[model samples]
Target chain A: MASYKELPKTAQIRLVSSHEEVYEPCDDSFALVDALLADRTKLLEHRPMLCMEIGCGSGYVITSLALILGQEGSGVNYIATDINPHAVRVTHETLEAHGVSAELIVTDIASGLEKRLAGLVDVMIVNPPYVPTPEDEVGAEGITASWAGGENGRSVIDRILPIADRLLSEKGWLYMVTLTANNPSEICLEMKKKGYASKIVVQRSTEEENLHIIKFWRDFDNEVDEINNQSTFMGSLLSQIPPFSFWRGNNGNDSDKNKC
Target chain B: MRLLTHNMLSSNIRGVVNGFPLRIEAGKVVEKNVEINGDFLKNMFVKIDWKAFVEASQSMGYTELPEEADSSMLDSDEFLNRFHHALLELHLEEGALVCPETGRRFPVSKGIPNMLLHEDEV
Candidate 1:
């Protein structure tokens, strides 16, 4: 296992700018590189793994993952993406400097994923924008999209959840990191509804805050339940038409009042 | 420069109004040598602001970029090579990104830019 203390200077930190500039530690990145490295032995056992790091700022974690994975001779392919071109440039530079190989894309998570990555990812990692305040815009550099999660700080995550549900493979795992301000229970519940089971893998308490890394796995058992429950009377009746067919084109449907 | 930081940046901090795009008044911009992973670049192409990228590159004296970029460009060695050099290789060691809106200057020294806002601006 690669020790965190032994990580190279580049892996330890990076200069990040979205609109403002700041020094970001590799550990401060949404996905922890050291943790990912430590998990490699177990990860490679499942060989030819495909990994993705979303919102990769300055290419810290993704480049680090590429370097480690490349050296291990494990067929680990990575896709690191961000919305800012500058970030893409920085990530590319980092990967080049480290001699690590991975695909880098510049795209927003809200616009759905690249078609090439569809249904092919084995592991997905995200360090989404979770800042809860609108006025808390300090240090929001070139990539405001990387930190702004909307009014409730859930807009970005909520938009990505549906896309994630479709992109992740049946046996794939998703690792996400966010601050305590977000409602963990609600996020897990949403994941559950999308046919995945989640667990908190890492939790840390700093001087004034708590941080969490949650891991989500596809629920195969739920697939069987869905299949078994498909033939029930209610299910059969619901299958023939759209769930909100009565409200099609505003047919005076007051059904929304009863939804909750 | 980070796009999020770029989005909030303006040159008119002194009293001007149209500081949408901050100009990079770099004295010395260096490009760190880094590798290029085509697959990752392809996926990321959709999210980048192409115009901003071109502008930044042009300001840095890279004038050979195509008028427009397409996904196919990711596979072009020439394009990738140039892009790699422009985006990843260039470093602004001594410069300032002047806000067009307020004319407030954010200085870049020793490869780092000070972006701390004033108490009143916050």
Candidate 2:
């Protein structure tokens, strides 16, 4: 049997703080962190200078990323933004509880930071509001802003794609969570036009939902004209992947730093 | 927020040009120790705007940073220490980041800046 020492370091569920108005960490959050964990080796080698999270909903994902990266001597910087003020505060407490820190801002996805962060971010992670809902429901207030994606769950995702493109450096990488309703394939083709090649890092399906964590990076080889011809093929290729992996509830137990 | 954040932030309000450095209104400043990494500091030096960074540190009541700096100065241990302190250690616990062009104030409460714009601003 694998001992506790073999377990990977991530944000402990007990250490993660929460607020009624803030979106609590759920399955989607777990999937995103698991993807990061699976890619931990590449991330360490990536040596990203600045890592950011667009919607740091309970701070679970960002905190997990920091722990996975082992921030002490790595000299990596973290920044997170959320539209809801309560989420930011809750995230702060979560980070504090874990002895990790990040610059948290209450903003509408990267607003007021575009010029300053443009082409500077090396790694950006997002668990966006990909849940489909009424258009008016999008950005309503509080927790609603956390999951209300208008019109086929593309409203917020659409807006963030352009901003992600602008802020990402030439070597930047983006990992985002998407629901099946959000049309992950079309999203990949859209990003392809902007010279980003994407691969699904994690795919999970449960009784009620299908989730995919997609990672995108600048691919100079994918020219604009070439993307037009490949769009249909790319769409089919992405859509055909079977959701074979079921996310195991690995975060069920509360484990502290000294457990090992 | 730290000066490194300040160095990267600008007044992104609509129709505002030349908002490279949002003027700092330091209300309450705090310093926390951060482990110094010379390689990180040296790499960041090329990307940082020295003039704006110096001005930011001065507003935070840290005047040790020189008015002008060059890459060669990064070799000095003293300069690196000051640079590290100014860049990462100092935090604006309670303050406001004023937009240079419109004089719009974005309040920084509990070290978290409220950068969300009103509907009109959007």
Candidate 3:
């Protein structure tokens, strides 16, 4: 277990731009970035060659990843995707404002990128649409795609998992945000079957939702003892670990005050 | 729209394959000074198609890059700076990203590419 070390700096909310239809940086975004910050030391040591963000609304999470991983002369390539053209536009503006650049694409999560990027991405991050809503509401043309997670909020999330598995390199690491209502344990189990070891980097409960930032990586040892390691991994993941409130005390910033 | 962005885009129109490395036809181009980051440029170099990048940069009126650069050149300060400049600073402010396979043109206005495809294409 790594100790929580404060980042040298995180993304400045004021520097993050917004659109009425695009989802702004809120608790989920902050917590996803917070998870990255908590694991920053490891990430810096990992020295990922390529980093990508799926559904990069406002480019907040990806920007924070760039800022968090932006060290002295480090070589990291960033690419972000979103279904909404408006979100892609906002993300482009936000990334420019922060002096970081990424290959921004407007698509459904890595749709056109499969052939080129398969098994090449070393670090992938997502703050997916995990809010459970009516099935029909999911994947709507506008801002609704940002949060309309239908049928246990797992629709978009489920779609992303297989794609992430395909894109992640042998040493890849994926950090994603999920709501408790989404049955995160089941998610972990599914990944474990794919031979990925998992850990909960950050778990926070706001006034409304219980959010979990889960990190998964390839582990051959765990795979060999699948039945045994799976149970233990599931036990520790769901029970032994304590969920901490990341936003408990800090009067963080303008981005922190934002909800939705 | 910088060359870096152009390098990752592809035409998503239905039935179109190999939409990668879109051909650039620029009506206007903008150059803004960005800090030269050697390490960043070196990493991007591996993934970007050198031929496509060189041709795109030339069409946009940038002629500093060589027709080919060996990895050894990554260590040269002069070469790295120019590589950094061409990739990051040169922007395709107004242009159309022409699909290599289908010949569809996605227009750029104010530096943002309009990638929205028609319903039939989707």
DockQ, cand. 1? 0.03
Model 2 residue B102 CA deviation in Å: 1.4
Better of 1 and 2 by DockQ: 2
Best by TM-score: 2
Candidate 2, which CAPRI tier? medium
- How should the candidates be ordered by DockQ, best one leading? 2, 3, 1
- Clashes (N, CA, C under 3 Å) per candidate: 60, 0, 0
Give a tens-digit lDDT track for model 2, residues A182-207: 87888888898788888889988756
Return whichever of 1 and 2 wins on TM-score. 2
Candidate 3 local lDDT, A1-260, one digit each (tens):
13433436666789888898899898899999989989989999998877999999998888888888873247676888888888988888888788877767667788766755777789999999877666887778878899878777789999999999998989999999987777888888899888898888988877766788999999977678998676677677779334433323214232322335
lDDT string for model 1 (A1-260, tens) is 46953553334343332223212433336335545654666555644356777777677777666655552234355666666556666766666666664555444552223333456577777877664545354125565556655444566777677767766766677778655556665676677667776666665545433456777888877655754543452343333222321211212232311110
In model 2, the clashing pairs are none
